[model samples]
Target: MIRMIVKDLRINPLRTGLTALSMFIGIVALIAGVLVGTLGRDYLEAVNARLSGRTPTYSAIIDVTSVAGMQTTMTLQERLAHFEPGSASAQYHLNDLAIWASSGDGGLEIRHVAVTVTDAERTRVMPAPIIEGAWLTAADKPATLETVVNENARQYVHDGTITLARTGNPQQVPARVNGVIVDGADEPVIYVNAAALQRYWPQAWTPDGLTILVHPDAGVDDRHAKTALDDLLADVGAGSVSSWNRSDNADEYEQVIDFLQLGVIVTAMLLLAVSAIGMINIGLAGIEQRSHELLIRRALGATRASIAAQVIGSSVLLSLIIALAAVLISASLVWMVPWMMPADSPLEPPAYPYTAAMIAAGASVATSLIGSLAPAIKAIRLQPALALR
Candidate 1:
């Protein structure tokens, strides 16, 4: 039966080739859709990680004008300063104080900058890619203020000593620009360690904003961490706290990607449906033209079931071959994507999506079986006596 099916398919090379080509296009489309969706989601995630930190990150603003708020802020600050790794509480907590400062070559030309005084944990909580130099460290000198400037600020500040003073204040302190980072900010921004700010400029040490980051590997769920933070704030009698999770924003982006993927897959499936319909039409026409041959097989003691199986088997085999070729081609393209991309590109290509290949192969076989059913039945119904007449 297998040999007979192979011989029948070989006799009509053009028809078989065209049918395989059509199914191959559909399979390729399915694979391409999945690859595109996976890569896009990965790229978005990487960008989000750099811009907004990793998943399960929380941001809050603490009002420090009241006595209770001030006490609570101090308590939180203490917890953050001595935060232990793998703790039940949040992984890293950062207190940020934004203030206006002045820098530049002190010859009557001053560049006003926005300075964010934060704990050294800011580097770990919401890490930015360092364009040059290094991030703040716990071992940094306390006597002199060391700062990391954003890309926008690097134009005015070099990797050397620059006089930094509060805006409108003549008491200038020398600050060293230890590093430069990409913070995605438009204006010039400087990052200073809160400890150094407290030691040198005690006036600007008060924080107005707070950031809480829970590492995914910390073995603590988001609900428990949030609840623990709420309890801590309640115990310290902190003022109104407004907090938001970064996962909410990430979910919105994910939903958009999922919708796009669904659309692409649906379109690809429609193309597959068209290919299947075309195959069915061609199969029925071939059956009509080969009625005499089928009659001869029946006269030679071939059962109706064997004839049907032979017709369907030929389609399944062709579809399997096409699916294998398409998957190989798609996998090759996925493997070459990283090399094709520019080195400086921010997004790194993800690995091949195996699930997509499996789906494409399965869908191809199913389509072939469905498209061959009618022709198989038609081939079996052919009468030997009528064909001989």
Candidate 2:
């Protein structure tokens, strides 16, 4: 039966090819739809991953004001415990100072280094990518003054230390560089435990802001979390605090992804439906043109069942060919597309979904079968003697 169907398709190559091409187009549309849906979700996942690398989980850095009367570690802890239940907290200060760096010419080069005084949450939430050594932990300080410097600070750090000295005051503190981190900055930056920095340089240090790590499924989202934090700060006369707005952005991003998915699916469905209708038309025309041949076979003792099967089998063969072509085209295009994209583009090229290809193939064959059913039945019901005339 398969050999006979193959022979028939081979005999009318042009007609068969054109009908298969229609289904092939539908398969392409289906593949594209799957890519669009998959890519949308993949894009979101990539964005979330990038953001997660930069930002800490359930963490927010808030602005503190003088009206808050210099937030102390003890005070912030009490406020967090009272309002934001089931949450963790930390404090950080972003400061800057001019440090004397070795210029490699044996001359001193003045480099401006950004300093951050952070609690354990610094490592927890916004953990920088560690390139060398280990990250700073709560236990890292008190025993020795340790600092994690960014890659930009490598030049200034000699003998595992850097000198911090102002113009008039010759007093210098040589901080031991514990680790090197990738902070995505062009300038030298250093992170140290807040208590250690303040304890050493009482006059140079000041509390800047607070960081809070919210827990997962903690019965609180960003808005509610922010509101709770704000209310707590306000009650303590902290005025207003600034946050990264991660929650708001995440919600908006998800909505956009959903919209893209819906559009792709609807468009693909329409294209597939049109293709199915076209295949049915082609099937009916083929049956009519081959009526004489079919009747001759029937008169030679072929059963109605065999005649119907032959017609349906031919449709299935055409669809299989179409599916093969679609797979080749889609795979090639998907593979080569990333090379054509710009280097710094935001959307990462998506991995081709093999499962989606199978679905497309299945849908195309099913449509082909349905399209050929009526034509097959019509051919079966025809009077063999009359058709043979």
Candidate 3:
């Protein structure tokens, strides 16, 4: 039956080739749309993660105006002092202080840079792509405080030392620039170790805001983690303490991606439908042209089911070949995405989306089956007596 189907397809090469070509185009479009949508969504997710930290990250603002606020802030600091690593409340905390510092290269001009005083765990909570050097570590703490600067700061700052001093204090300290990172910040920013900053200039170590990130392996949900964090800082005598989760901001971006993917799927489906229509038309015409041949097969003891199988099998085989080719092309395109992106972009291209390829293959097979139905039915209905006529 397979040999007979192959022979019949080869007899009308132009018609078969045209039908296969149309279906092939549709499969390629479907695969491309899925690949683009999946990759685009992943890129957005990575950008969001870099800017706002990973999901479930909670940020709290401590109000320091009132007397109670001052006491609460002091209490929070006291609690942080006794923090033990690997405890039940093993949450990672990050704090930042905005300070004015002068560079030897800048001479008389002092630059305002945000100094993020955090531990090595900062990367696990809020990941920033390292551009030149490495992230902060315990070993980075020395007499000359090692700091990582963002891309904006690297414009004026080199891999050397910068002077840090309070606005009115005559005392100055030197901080070494160890590396550069992309933190998605518009202004100049520097990251330093909390212990090093506190040792050199305790006054400049005061945090303007606090960010608490719950560890994924901490075995606690967001609600419980937020409650634990609030309880930990409850001693802050501030007028009001407000907190928000990163997921709140991430939802908006996710909705936009969902809409885009929906549109792509719909468009791809339309293209497949058009291709299916072309296949159905060509299949029916081919059956009509080979009516006498089918009648001869019927006379040679071929059952209706066998004749129908031959027609449908030809379409399924052609579509399977097209689907495989389309998947290979789409995979190659996905692999080349990183090379196409700008060097400054922090978004890392994700791996090829195998789910999209599977979907495309399924759609191809279903479309072929649907398109071949009419031709299969027509082929089976032809009487054996027609061969004698």
What lDDT does each candidate get? 0.68, 0.69, 0.69
Q: Which parts of model 3 are misplaced by more than 4 Å? A: 62-107, 138-144, 169-172, 206-219, 230-248, 295-303, 336-345, 381-389
Residue 306 in model 1: shift from native, Å? Answer: 2.5
**Global fold similarity of model 1 (TM-score):** 0.72
Per-residue lDDT of 202 in model 2: 57
* Tens digits of lDDT, candidate 1, 7-119: 87897888898789878988888888777777777666666765666554665444433422333444655565454432222222223333323435444444555766555
For residues 16-135, write the lDDT of model 2, one tens digit per residue: 977888998899988988897887776564455333422224556666664223345435544554444434445565444457776779887666577665554454344355668876
Candidate achieving the largest TM-score: 3
Candidate 3's TM-score reads: 0.77
Which is the better candidate, 1 or 3, if ranked by TM-score? 3
What residue pairs clash in candidate 2, if any at all?
A: 56-125, 63-242
Show model 2 residue runs off by greater than 4 Å.
Answer: 44-204, 213-248, 335-349
TM-score (C-alpha) between model 2 and the true structure: 0.60
Instruction: Please give the distance, in angstroms, between residue 148's alpha carbon in candidate 2 and its true position after superposition.
Output: 13
